[model samples]
Target: MSTQAKRATIYFDPDIHKALKIKSLETSRSITDLVNQAVKEALSDDVEDILSFEERKNEPLISYDQMVKKLRKDGRI
Candidate 1:
């Protein structure tokens, strides 16, 4: 069963609106559908990143001074 989409109006610059319309026509999807999909993907990726950082939070901490000293010794600074 497909979900029914709601109607909403958003204002965009004329050129952006034209480009979006053209892309929508070429891709055979509505502008709303494209925008919703993009937002969903971005949110999902952020969630993944948050989980990754939480997993690594306790690994280690390096001071800036120590990092610079090491870099200088290694001729990387």
Candidate 2:
């Protein structure tokens, strides 16, 4: 409702739009806020995965069966 807010239109099914509107009213937050928060959470998860992958960049890749066999051989099973 801010005069300085930017307007962008997104398409949704009628039912979905209705649900979002109801949720917005129930939560006392704008649709933009809900969408922005969800998007931010998704992007943050992706960033976490990227960082985790980078940290494990030097880890040796092993298949599931290979791992089981190795564990059995090592008597660690």
Question: Which has the greatest lDDT?
Answer: 2
Candidate 2 lDDT by residue in tens digits, 1-77: 44576678899899988998999999999989888788779999999999999999999999999999999999999
Instruction: State the C-alpha lDDT per candidate.
Output: 0.90, 0.91
Candidate 1 local lDDT, 1-77, one digit each (tens)? 16877778888899988999999999999888888888789999999999999999998888999899999999997
Candidate 1 overall lDDT versus native: 0.90
Model 2 weakest lDDT span, ten residues long: 1-10
User: Over all chains combined, what TM-score does candidate 1 have?
Assistant: 0.71
Query: Each candidate's TM vs. the true structure?
Result: 0.71, 0.72
